[model samples]
Every structure is written in structure tokens, then in C-alpha cells.
Target: MRRVIIIVLVLLPLAVLAVWIGVRAHRLRPKSAIPAGTSATAPGPQLPSPSSCGAAGRSQLEHYDRSTVYDWLDGGAAPYLDHGFTTSTVATYRFETGGRTLTIEAAAVRFASPRGAAAQAAAETPPGAAPVPGLPGAHSTRDVLVWCRGRDMLRLVSFTPGAETSGPFAALARAWLGGTAP
Candidate 1:
């Protein structure tokens, strides 16, 4: 009976101390801190998207010689071409640089549109010319030219078709643009 009493006395005090330390430690932690055992090394606010990043999506060292841009292409029939079977029309862009004119949009044809080839071809035909048959889902496409001189890169992007993306995609875009990634 005496040994049992002594053992309880020692264990009871230790248990109380342990409970006190645990409560104190819990209260001391910041409300914002992630719980222990979380996988992420650093956790906090996340970026919305890469597009929001200043130059993200928009290329760095980007500048286009507007003068080099020659034509706004529309796809349609090629009844006018020498080797014609109602092929799509090719819009031409003419440019003069270093005393040499370089055309940019000579290859303006849609080879694989869901719409019938006829409709795809019709998108390019000049409006005044005899109206060409349009494909069911044929669409007029608009593109932009961006040249990153330092990178020696020429990019053509379709902005007419507004894009849809998820939160993570937006965050990634914003990050690439300039914001911090998630």
C-alpha cells in the first residue's frame, strides 16, 4: 500500500505537467500556421493566374513591327487560282525591311477544319466574289503577331477565341506573367 501511494504520487505529477505543456504549446502556435505534419514546406497566399503576371502570356522582349503585318486573312473559295478546285483563298501580307520586303501571312489556309473543306475554303473568298458555300461550323479566326527580338521568336496567337481556364491555370498564367506561383 505504501509503494502504490508513492508510485501514484510520482506519475500523477508527471501527467499534470504533461497536460500543462501540451495546452501551453497549443495556445502558443500562430492561428495562421499550418498544422504539424503538413506536407508543404511553405504555405501561404497563392497567385490567381499567370496571365495576371505583368508580362506573362505577353512575352518578354516582345515588339512587333506593325509595318511588317500585311493582311487580315479570311478563309474561303479559291475559284480565282490557276489550279483551282474551290480552294481557300490565301491572304498576303507585304513588308519592307532592310530594303527588302518580307511577306508574313502567305500561308493562310486551314487544312483540317471540322467544317467541310468547301466551307473552310469559303472563309477566304473575297466578299464581292460569288458567295461560296459555308461549312456548318466554319469560323473566322483572328490572330496577333508578337516578335521577341532577343529570343528570336515569332509567335502568332488567336485572341479572338477568348480562353477559359481553371483557378490553377490562372494562377500558373499569372505566375508566368509575373506573379508568384502557388
Candidate 2:
């Protein structure tokens, strides 16, 4: 009986640790922002094609609606949800510049009205971000750009720090905005 108790004491902790790890991994697993029964290729807002923005290949777009925005934005979804966010489309593009490839993530959020988009943009703009040249309602920093066009608010972020102000970043933003006519 003593030997059995000792064995149980040793194995119990290992079993508990295994279960903990499993629970943690289940929580951390990527959640699908797309709603069930909806096709991923469902028609929606048009983002600039990767090739048009000088990217190596096409981008795979993921969409999120008001119900599932948190799966994509996590804690950052609150402000968007509060501001009448309707839908959002996100994509990642790889651009080769100066012999180095950079990954840029872009998200286009549509609101119920132009007012909602403007409000969200203004709320997200930092104190000293410079206005993007020739793009009304657009602001930029070293690694991020936020812009609003009519009922849509578009954001671009560079995974590699300090690449936000690069030429490729601006070109991609411009291409997207040009294609997204009000």
C-alpha cells in the first residue's frame, strides 16, 4: 500500500502538468475569425492585390465580422466594436526591397458610416504621428499607418520595426487607397 501511494503521488503531478499544458495549448490555438458555414472567398471589400503592390505573390485574405473580430484583434477589438465596426478584412504581404524581404500586415475595417470610420481613425492616431502626404485623414509613424476613406478605415503595420516609413510601405498604402474609391 505504501509503494502504491508513492507511485500515485509521483504520477499525479505529471498527469496534472500534462493536463495544464493541454489546456494552455487549446486556449492558445489560433481561432478562426471567419464565421461558420461562410466561405473564405466571400465577396467583400477589395484590398490591393499583392502583385500590384510589388509583392512576390498573392495575399490570402481573412475576414472577420462584428461577432468574431476578437478572434483576430484579441484585446484590440473593443474600440473597433464600440465604433460601429461592420466588417474587417486582413492580409499579409511580403515585399522584396533592397534584397531583403519584409512582411507587412494590412487590415481594412468598414464601419456603419463615414462618421464612425473618422471617429475610429482619430481615436487611434497618436499624438505626433505625421499626416501621410496627399492622403486626407491618413497618419503615419515609423512602422504604422492609419487612414480613413469614407466608411472604411485602413491600417498597415510592419512586422519588422522601423520599416513603416519605407518606400514600399507608402507604395502599398497608396495602391490600396487608390483602388478603394469613395
Candidate 3:
């Protein structure tokens, strides 16, 4: 009976540990970035392909709905949520320039209306942002460019200083905006 009890005690903890590991693995598994009921290849506004912008590589697209926006934006999700955000798609692109690699992050967020998009863009615009040429409702700073069209807003950000003026930035923005026809 004592041997059986010892075996039970050891087996219980092992079982518990196995269950814990399973739970952790489940939580860590990658969730489908595409929204439910939507085909992965559905025709829609998509992030610009790397080849379209001369990017060396591009990350997989990630889509976030209202419920999961926080997973991507955390505290910054509040403004978007308040502005009737519908969905957001994000990706990163890498470009080789001047013997260095630059990473530009891009996001396309859709709102309930054009008014909401303009409001959100206005809220994010800094005092000194200059309007981007040929792209109405678009502005660019030293490292960030933001634009709104209809009910969609697109932002391209670069951490590399002064990357906003690089070839990749312009190409990517142009390619992305070109694909976002009203």
C-alpha cells in the first residue's frame, strides 16, 4: 500500500507537469492572423509585396480585429478603438540601402467611416509633420508617414533615423497606396 501511494504521488505530479506544459504550449501556439470566415487569399487591400517595393524580404501579414487589437497595439489601441476601428493588418519589410539593412514596419487600419479615419489620423499627426506629395491626408515626419483614405489609414514607420526619405519608404508607400484604390 505504501509503495502504491508513493507511485501515485510521483505519477500525480508528473501528470500535473505534463498538463501544465500542454497548456503553455497551447497558449504559445501561433493564432491564425486572418479573421474567421475570411479566405486567406481573399481579394482586398493587401500589404505591398516585397518585390513591389524592392524590399529584400517581408514578414507574414498579421491581421487583428477589435478583440485582438490589444495584442498588437497594447496601450496604443485605445485611440483606434475609440475611433471605431474595424481591423488592422501589419507587416515588416527589409531593404538594403547604403550598405545597411533598414526595416520598415507598415500597418493598414480600417475604420467604420471616412470621418473616423480622418479623426484618428488627425489625432496622431504631429505639429511638424509635412504633407506627403500627391497623397492627400498623408503626412511625413523624419521617421514616420501616416495617411488616411476613405475609411482606411496606412502608416509606415522606420526606426532607422532619417529612413523616411529612403527609396524603400517611398516605393513601399507608393506601392501600398496604389493598391488601396477607393
Using all chains and alpha carbons, the TM-scores for the candidates as numbered come to: 0.19, 0.72, 0.72
lDDT of 3 by residue, 29-72 (tens): 86776544222332334688888878889887777777777877
Q: Candidate 2: lDDT over CA atoms?
A: 0.79
The numbered model that scores best in lDDT is 3
How high is the lDDT of residue 154 in model 2?
A: 85
List ranges where model 2 is wrong by over 4 Å.
Answer: 1-39, 180-182
lDDT of 2 by residue, 1-182 (tens): 99999999999999999999999999898667644422365455567887667777546788788777787778888988888898877888888888777888888889988999999999877778898777776888878888889998888888788654457667777888778521
RMSD of 2: 10.9
Q: Ten consecutive residues with minimal summed lDDT in candidate 3? A: 35-44
Candidate 2 lDDT trough over 10 residues, lowest sum: 34-43
- The residue pairs in collision within model 2 are none
> Model 1, range 1-182, lDDT digits (tens) per residue?
99999999999999999999999999887756543222222222222221342222222121112111121221212322212222122222333334543332212222222233343244343344321122122222223332111111112233223332122222222232242332
Order by TM-score, highest first:
2, 3, 1
Report every candidate's CA lDDT.
0.30, 0.79, 0.79
TM-score, structure 1 vs. true: 0.19
